[model samples]
Target: MTLYGLTAAPVARRLGAVRPARARPLLVGGDPWAVELARALRSAGLEVLMWAGSEEQRERIREAGLELAPGELLAAATGRGARLEGITAVLLLTDEDDFNALASTVLSRGAGIPVHRLGPRSGDHGVVAPYGGDDTLLAPGLTRLGVAHRHAQGAHIVTHRVDTTAGTLPDRHDLLLLVRPDGRLVPADGRAAPAPQPGDIAVMRPRC
Candidate 1:
């Protein structure tokens, strides 16, 4: 909230908090993987938004039928936009490792918002301690390098309902995100376990 918004605490209490019950995640990257994820989220009945630093990225993001976040990346993601409203979480998947780490730290600290970033390229030498591990931010093969390589090889993201009785989950697949029956959106980038109950929609990718 801005300085002016701070004074409206009593008014806010009467009106109600900004966010709704369901999750509205704001993706903070401009890759094809990000676009696919955003589309799947919307299809699953969650409102999704994306932020792109370049015009090329914005064009593709819009072409995918997603909305673009206004203002700069960190500012908008940190609730410094028009208002600290619907956005529930920020997923930082930019190719730049340092920028992702920096933004992750800032959003977690300043904004008090949940943040998830891509697996860092910096390893142990990284300036941010939390974003160092391959499994820390995202799953091993979901990083920019890994996703880019797979995208080039015809691997695409897919969303499906979890019906254990139908068959076992695919062997060579990675679970990216999960949308529960209650409209809770969960990111399964190794940060969260895959709890697939019947009738849940899962966002996944082939391990090819």
Candidate 2:
């Protein structure tokens, strides 16, 4: 699916290049947002361990066809008896603010994992630091969540000029460019921009 012209294809490609090869089990705190995040993570070939708080939540997770584990089991999974290894990240999706905050602290301190938290706000907000800690604050709506994810993933925002008379850009034309770590843009035609060191934004307009 496309979100603000950012599709999974480009997002996945850029993510693949930067993401570690080993699959990590994402520990999700139970909620609707967690459910959706689990789907997206699984689609990216990552394992998910759901820690739902109630039977109703468990049933909802089961209906979604995902694996479920008790919240208590999460501490164990991240501990000695862990069946999975190389946990790359953690997602805190619980509705309760206190619970999510506690989980974030534990995951970061105990497992040394990067944590993304969903909060009760109106727009997506995030804080990323050089010390390997980041927080993603999610609002009430789903669209904002996607925007938040892309922003967290460090995707560059691009606005293309669409000719109202002729229509949008051609399918082969690059409407949005996913910026790389070195500041280069990746497109289908193998064209690259001048190296864009960090903090540079690239803008291009289609020829009339």
Candidate 3:
């Protein structure tokens, strides 16, 4: 199976190439993926703060000479009502899927920060970072996760969401499969277009 690098149309449009302040990515995990992600983020000119998963991991992080963030400290720093002083984005690379999901939810809800995941392949609706040693791709800001599935003939199917209340509605097309809040897929085929509301998912196969 071929895994293509993720490209975001909405995120790129929102964050134009103006080059904002350097990013400070918070990486949580102690695995090689976390280390590699840190290196990649640094190479991208982003400041990194790493959190070790255990005592063994702590030694590794320290040996790597990265800023070590403890669990308690991170919780206090990113707790509810805490101000976002300088965090650009968050990467949850834990081995456990549950912790990763919880951390993503808490951080996103508490500080309005976007969290991405690196390990544990499929399951949650979190941002999945494709990571290789010293060669990872992590874009700035929130990236809603999506998937591509094979379709009949030479076409491919892609799906994404517009769940956030403040999210902009993408262009409407007849091939688009828009899911409503009540779990119904609304097709853009010949019917009155539904109003763009919260909790809508759009699926489409880009015509090449």
Any runs in candidate 1 off by more than 4 Å, and if so which?
1-17, 73-81, 110-112, 122-126, 129-135, 164-168, 191-193
lDDT of 3 by residue, 1-208 (tens): 1111112232222222232266565667766535644554454344677766477766787887777764433333434221224555666556654455544444544444444553334434334322212111122211212111122233344455665876455443223335555434343332233455566665444443
Q: Candidate 1 has what TM-score? A: 0.77
How would the candidate models be sorted by lDDT, starting from the highest?
A: 1, 3, 2
Q: Which number leads on lDDT?
A: 1
Q: What TM-score, computed on C-alpha atoms, does each candidate reach?
A: 0.77, 0.46, 0.44
Clashing residue pairs in candidate 3 are none
Per-candidate alpha-carbon RMSD to the true structure: 6.0, 13.6, 15.7
Arrange candidates by TM-score, descending. Answer: 1, 2, 3
| Error at 153, model 2, angstroms | 26
lDDT of 3: 0.45
Better model by TM-score: candidate 2 vs candidate 3: 2
- Writing each residue's lDDT as its tens digit, candidate 2 over 1-208 gives 0011211232222212233455454545545545655654454445555656567777888888887753334343434332334345555555554455445554554454455554433223323111222354322222334544554564433333334355334342222222233322222111222332333232322222
